[model samples]
Target: MFSLPQRLAAEALGTGLLVATVVGSGIMASSLTQDTALALLGNTLPTGAILVVLITILAPISGAHFNPAVSLVFAFRRELSAQEAIMYALAQIVGGIVGTIAAHVMFALPLLDASTKIRTGGAQWFAEWVATFGLVFTILAALRFARASVPWLVGLYITAAYWFTASTSFANPAVAIARAFTNTFAGIRPADLPGFIAAQLLGALCALAFAGWLLREQSDATQPLNAEAKP
Candidate 1:
């Protein structure tokens, strides 16, 4: 088990890398292809792949909580200590900011301009909700039924989310915050942050509840057999 600070630091670093790769790739893809859909697919596919690989490599070390919502769910499940959860959430936020700054500097993208970024509104809000719900639910299911294969499952989930969800399934809080820093096609507005974050958090909570229910069913199904065997 890592110390609280160490785990938090790993989350921060991992989230930073995640944002940088996703956003930076989006920038490059947009420049290469003027088509919005193509650019999005080009950027997101590789980003999703990288996220799976990185999380698998880092999960045992730091739990790979690159999103605040994920950390909150873990805390709710009693899988993570409360103090560590708080620290991880804080680290994720800071890491998001840092990652955005790094992307801006490295890509020479404008940081303060609101017009250059992508944001949610109108139908986009519904999209965000759907995306987040899918993401959280998939993550929970993977943890329960496919913990040993989480990396591949997470990758496929994110990839599918990009296509199915209108907001492109930016389900990670760190990813969302980091995106706000760039004034590019991938950037999200600061004004819209609260609503999106709220939606994602709600989605996570709902997923957690669903996961609990499923676990209870599994436990109940197993208990009767165990009781019979004991007699």
Candidate 2:
């Protein structure tokens, strides 16, 4: 078993890479492609692909929770301690910022800049709620019925969400916060972070509560997937 510190490190490292992939791919996509649809397609594929790989490889170590919303949900379910949940959120946020900086540096851009990408509105907030709800719901459902397929399920959900949601499915609070630091293709205005994060957290809690009821008949529905502090 990995130590708590080691697990934390895995969470941090995995989250860093996840955001790096997200921001980097967006930058590359907008840079290389003229068509908006093609640029979005470019952003979607690699993000989903890398998410699968990251989760699969890091799940055993840290549950591969690159999102504060997910961590909070797990904590609410008692799969992770309150302290651990707080630390995980912190780690993910820190990792996300580092990842943003890394992506900027790789693109020969400034290390830090506020995002001006306006992403605020009722529709956007609602989309975030839906996206995060589906994310947590998928995770809970998959662990019970299709443990082996969780990676792909999540990847596919996010891939689909990217297209379906106006917010491009930022389902992750840490990602939302980190993206606020950049003025790039994937960036979100810092002013928009509060609403997005609030929606995401609420969505996660709502999903866990609803999933508990929806999957009540299943024995594994209430089981803790992150019981060992890992998936």
Candidate 3:
């Protein structure tokens, strides 16, 4: 229903707001509490809530794909042109970075500080893979079976995944990259990015393949040729 440029703008705006919510909430939560679990809960809720809000409002415009991994999955399915997918990714990445800066400005912190927070190791990478895999699966399956519930499905999944996953579920590459620029409760070190991103991409692709198999419909050739004519 929206034009390409308008869709791109929606993507940039949605991703920017999503990242801002993530970083801002993390900063607020950490500042409010020294308890790690409590802080994480604070961060998790806002991220999930924002996803639901953003997706509901912006899905018609740009499919509300705030993550590059999600965008790539759509591109692979041929639901979006490869060139449009690339443009969406670029907008998301740029918007995410701007989001970090927005968060920092709100908190009176320095803009664009490289994160010192370290998040690395096999466990973290595996957690990211699992996290992203679940996310993509949820989206595809919901789109197939319960299209109206996608926003809630995704929101609830991330809310739960945040606590279950060891990495607190940095499932989105754009969000991860944005987090790398903040020295906050939600930040991951820049050096650790490659592994997380790689794991996320692999996980997303696997979900696409699995969903293709699992959600596929039986061929119409199996039905009698006169079935439609009878109706």
Candidate 4:
């Protein structure tokens, strides 16, 4: 088995690259296009594509759970211990912050700044819940019936969620928190984080409950998204 540190490192590195791709692509997209739709399109593609690659490459190590919500959900399902989930959550948050900083450095912007994009309201909260519900549901369902398609399924779902959701699908707590530190196109206001995160947690729980009901427990079932792990 890979050591805890090794698993943590993979989670951190994978999350960092994922956020870098998100923030960097948003910046580049905004710079290249005046139309908001076009810029969003540009931002969506690379983030989705990178998600596939990162999850596929890192699934063996840490299940590539770059989101705290995902780790928490896994813990609830007993796929991961509570301690491991907490450690993964911390690593993901730190990695997300570092990734945001890296993007700022690459773009020659300020290292850290609170976002001014005021995203709040019941509609936004509901959007977050929907987005996260879809995300966790996708992960649970795909990992059960179509293990090989998880990367594509998750990537494509997020890509679509980005456009369909009102809040642009910041379905990840760590991503939302790290993004709050940036005043970029993809950033969210820090004050708005509590509601978003609460909604995400709720959504994750709902998805887990639904998954338990939907699938009959099987001894032969794979270990969630950690199917690629090697001893």
Candidate 5:
């Protein structure tokens, strides 16, 4: 029973730390290695590990929705008011940028540089959609059946999505927007933001729709009986 302001604060703090981990790790990984695969592996693990830590600590306050897509999903599900969702998104976006700046400061890079990395195409767009869809679905399903396991579930899903998805699974709109501010290995070009955000939102909505139907609890009459159950 946290207040709205408290929840918003938690969201901001959690998102900030998440982005710091992402951008910082990316900068470090690239500096350490020339191998693309190894660099990606370096970027992937910290992001996933931080998700688990942030969600575990902050979920009680703000549902640990560090992603605009995740906040939007909760709004659609009627868990959060539309205004709350919007505020949460604003906090997350702002926090993410601040985190990026912090990462840059730590590495002595420019505080706010637009990314030059070119990351846009139909394949990547579709991959963003798939990545976000999987993320939201994992959250929804885990909440329904194993509420306590949501942290690990989401962390692991994003870790795997990073490897399997062509886009490295930016899956989070706030994160995607923040990453656009950095010119590091984790960054995406500012011009590519729109497509990624659009795909993420659409994927989240689709997951909401799919999970709604799939997670509905069946009545006893609708449940299938085991073959060994005697009449």
Candidate 6:
């Protein structure tokens, strides 16, 4: 295992790459597809595939926490230290900015304008909530029930979420912030960011509660077996 700083750095780099690929691909897909559903599929399928690969490759090194909400949830579960969670969250935010800047340069895209990016309305806020809630719930369950197989399960969760949730299941705060830096179809306007962020955070909190319940149930189930084995 890596030292804390090394792990944090790996997480930052991995998350940066993840967001860059996702937003960059979304831009390309939207430009290519005139149909909304087709464009969404084009954007999210590749994003989900990349997420699976990245998590598999990076989880052992950095815990693969590409989102602040995810880091927070892990901290609550005692899977991550509070100090590490804070550091990881900061790294994720900074990495998001860096990724968006790189994408801008690579694509020769015009600088993002707050006026032109997509607005976050009521529907969008609800979408953010549902998307993030599903993501966090799925991740926590996978960790608890299939600890050794979380990467593949997480990948499937993301893929299914993309098809089901609104906001294309952009559940990661890093990805949301990064999207603000691009004026593409995937981009969210700065003016509309607060609502989306608030919604996602709320969803994360709900997931935490659910995780606690699940953990309690597991502990209760195991206690009887432990007692029976005592001398």
Q: Which candidate has the top score in lDDT?
A: 5
Ranking by TM-score: 5, 3, 2, 4, 1, 6
Query: Candidate 6 lDDT, tens digit per residue, 1-231?
Result: 689988888788878888778777777888788888888888777778877888888888998988999998888878889998999998998887777777667778764433257757888788889989888888888877888778777778887888777666778887788787777767888777788888888899898897778665544656656555757
lDDT, residue 40, candidate 2: 95
lDDT of 2 by residue, 2-115 (tens): 788988888888888988899999999999988989999999999999889999999999999999999998898898999999999999999999999999999999998899
lDDT of the candidates, in the order given: 0.79, 0.92, 0.95, 0.92, 0.96, 0.80
Mind giving the per-residue lDDT tens digits that candidate 4 earns over 1-231? Answer: 788999999988988888888899999999999999999999999989999999999998889989999999999889899999999999999999998999999999998879998999999999999999999999999988999999999999999999999999989998998889889889989999999999999998898898888876746575465767887
Off by over 4 Å in 1: 110-118, 218-231
Pairs that clash in candidate 2? none
**Distance from true location, Cα of 94 in model 2, Å:** 0.4
Task: Sort the predicted structures by lDDT, highest score first.
Answer: 5, 3, 2, 4, 6, 1
Q: 1-231 in candidate 1: lDDT tens per residue?
A: 777777878898888888778777887898899998899888878888888887888898888879888899999989888987888888988887787777677878665345345466766676776777677777788877889788787778888888888788888776787787677767888777777888888878888887778765544656656555754
**Residue-level lDDT tens digits of model 3 in 85-140:** 99999999999999999999999999999999999999999999999999999999
What local lDDT score does residue 110 receive in model 4, on the 0 to 100 scale? 94
Off by over 4 Å in 6: 111-115, 218-231
CA lDDT of 53 in candidate 1? 83
Q: Evaluate model 3: give its TM-score.
A: 0.94
TM-scores of all candidate predictions against the true structure? 0.88, 0.93, 0.94, 0.92, 0.95, 0.88
- Using TM-score, give the best candidate's number: 5
Off by over 4 Å in 4: 217-231
- Give the Cα error of residue 145 in candidate 3, in Å: 0.7
* Residue 222's lDDT in candidate 6: 61
Regarding lDDT, does 5 or 6 come out ahead? 5
RMSD of 5: 2.0
The candidate, 1 or 4, that scores higher on TM-score is 4
Instruction: Decide which is better by lDDT, 1 or 6.
Output: 6
CA shift of 95, model 2, Å: 0.5
What shift in Å separates residue 134 of candidate 1 from its native position after superposition?
1.9
